[model samples]
Target: MRADAKKNREQVLAAAGIAISEQGVDVSLRDVSRRAGVGLATLLRHYPTREALLEALLHTSFAELTAKAGELETSSSPEEALVSWLRDCTAWTTQYQGVTELMAAAIEDVESALHASCVALRAAGARLLTRAQAAGAARADIDGTDLFALVAALAWVGDQPSLESRADHLFDVVVSAILTCAPVLGDRRPTEEVSS
Candidate 1:
């Protein structure tokens, strides 16, 4: 792609993210073009259809998330990395409820960009879960599929308008449940435990 075209595409995706968050996935292309400060024709040139635009947005978000997880692999502790990644994941999901809906649509259709993201997310989650388990700080029985489902459910919970105030606490509970051998209640860190 030309440099200008790539920049325009990036702008459109960024604008679409905000528009979708503020309005919804059903937000019109004209609105997205306005938000992007681009002509509708240019926006259409980048993403010919609403589904195409949505798929690009989802793909971008998922790629960023996967990259973050990969970078976190070098963290001092797998447990901390996992918790941090989960928090990031929650924020990403909550930030774009439209993406969640798009994903669901793709799953039902089974031939959308969301389907590709599902595969990628599962692979990334498996890597994280495996690392956490290897560190002896996460449940071995919990598979990537289970974690994916959990994240999806958490995203839905986070999307609730009424639950907005309690989102952090809700996510904390999830983290607590997933963290094995974590200092519980009033217990102090084990004397020989490696610090995170």
Candidate 2:
């Protein structure tokens, strides 16, 4: 790519990140172009579709999360690895508005630009989950698919304004449910003390 073209692509991607973070995956291409100070045609030239733009934006994050899962698998106990990775993954999904839906859809569609990255990320989490189950720490009935769905569910619940306050409590509940041998209540964080 020419230097100018590369610079233009970077600007569009940067703008798209800001737009999507603020307005979600559904944010219009026009809005992103406007924010980038580029013409719509230029944006289209760089990212032909919303999925393409999202793939560019999230692929790095997905790789990092996958790497994190690998690190946790080696460094933490089975149960701790699963719980920490779950928490981190769920927290990540909450960053971009409506991204849970995008990730769910992308993972199921091989033609989607994000399919590969999403699958890799899911596999990383699955490794952690399997480790936990093998150690008799996490529930054996659930598999990686179930775990991904649960993460997406948690992200969706956290996305709602009415449930935002309850998200942490809900996370704890989900974590407890995932564990075959639950942690002592006192060992948990996040003020399980929400007098709600």
Candidate 3:
């Protein structure tokens, strides 16, 4: 890309990030263009649609979460890794207002621009889940897709004003239910049978 074009893209993304964070995912693209000091044509040329713009804004975060899953797989016990990463996913989804809903929709819509990123993010969680199950820490009946859904659900709940404080308790309860052998309370390590 030409220097000027790249600059325009960056500006649009930056302005969109602020607008979306402050206003919402539904913030006007025209406003984004105005904030970025770019024309509507240029904004459309770069992002094409609101979903495309959101995808661009969230791509880096999704990629980082995916990479973090890989790192956690090696650094923490399987159960610990899964639990830690789920918390991270929740935080990521709730970064801005209404993002959890957008993510839930995007993950199911193959046609959406954000779908690929959502898929990659879910795949990462699935990898950790697979490892946890294989190690006999997680329930064998559940799959990566199931884990992804649970994460999304928790994020959705977290987004609710009345449920925000209960999110951690809900996470713990759900995660415990998903485990084959319940983890010791407050302990992140896998059980002796699984670890050995």
Candidate 4:
């Protein structure tokens, strides 16, 4: 790419990131162009579609998540690593309004520009989940796709105005359901009873 073209691309990517973070993933391309001090044509020249822009913006984050999974595999307990990564994924999906839905669609459409990034993100989560399952911390029946759906569901709940306050509780409940050794609710067994 030419120097000016590259510069314009970088500006658009930066502006899009800020706009998406503040206004949401659905922010208009015109607004992103204005923020980048470029024309709509220029923005289009760099990223032909909104999904293209989002893919560019999220490329680094996807790469980092993949790298983090590798690092966490050896650095933390399997369950801890899986939980931490799931939280991170939830935060990432919820960072921009509507992003979780966008990613869900992207992951299913090979033609979408964001598909690769979504796949990478799922692969990273899969690594952590595999480790957890191997350690008997997570349920073996749940796969990476299942975990991704759960994260997206959590993010979608967080996006709702009425349910936002309960997102944390919902997250805990969902995670517990996915864990093989999670304590059941109101299970007043010997473990919960005071032994005489």
Q: List the residue pairs that clash in candidate 4.
A: none
Clashing pairs in 2: none
Best by lDDT: 2
Give a tens-digit lDDT track for model 3, residues 1-196.
9999999999999999889877879999999999999999999999998988999999999999999999999999999899889889987776677787787788889998889988999899999999998998998898878888898788788778777766777777888898877666464332222335
lDDT against the true structure, each candidate:
0.78, 0.90, 0.86, 0.85
Could you give the candidate ranking by lDDT, starting with the highest? 2, 3, 4, 1
Give the C-alpha miss distance for residue 185 in model 2, angstroms. Answer: 6.5
Identify the candidate with maximal TM-score.
2
Q: Is candidate 1 or candidate 3 better by TM-score?
A: 3
Encode model 2's per-residue lDDT on 63-89: one tens digit a residue. 999999999989999998898899899
TM-score of each: 0.79, 0.92, 0.84, 0.86
What is the per-residue lDDT of model 1 for residues 1-196, given as tens digits with 9 covering 90 to 100?
Answer: 8999999999999999999888878899999999999999999988999888988888877888888888888864788777777778767877776566566556556667567776776677678889999889998889887777678778888788776665666666777788787533333232343459
Q: After superposition, how far is residue 70 of candidate 4 from its true place, in Å?
A: 1.3
Looking at model 3, report the run of 10 residues with the lowest lDDT sum. 187-196
